[model samples]
Target: MAEPSITIRDNGPYVVTMPVEILDAKGNPLTITRERITLCRCGASNNKPFCDGTHNKINFESQVSA
Candidate 1:
């Protein structure tokens, strides 16, 4: 099995590529059907943890470097 890869997008969501599961507050797994997932960053997404392209409308700016 391959390891997961995560990328922080500029002014966007956290792009993740893995086979890991996303659990909720109750420890229940969220239903998702995609090879990759984009998580919210600006805390203004209607989808909560998921990215609904709300950052672009709010003009969120964040660039990560290591």
Candidate 2:
């Protein structure tokens, strides 16, 4: 398997490309059926921990570089 990568988008959610196990607060595994997923960063999604395109609605702004 290739190493997983997490990419920070331009004012958007973090894009993850890899098979992963998502956990809840109690350490319970959250079901993820896809290798590619978008994680919420703007804290505006009705679906917590996942991106639901709410950032675009709220006009969220963030830019990070290495």
- Model 2, 1-66: lDDT tens digits are 656889999899999887777789999998887878999999999998999999999999999999
Q: What's model 2's lDDT at 36? A: 89
Model 1 per-residue lDDT tens digits across residues 1-66: 457788899889998886779899999998887878999988999998999999999999998888
Error of 2 at 57 (Å): 0.9
Cα displacement (Å) at residue 45, model 1: 0.5
Q: In candidate 2, which residue pairs get closer than 3 Å at backbone N, Cα or C atoms, i.e. clash? A: none
Per lDDT, the best of the predicted structures is 2
lDDT of 2 at 15: 94
Winning model by TM-score: 2
lDDT of 2 at 57: 98
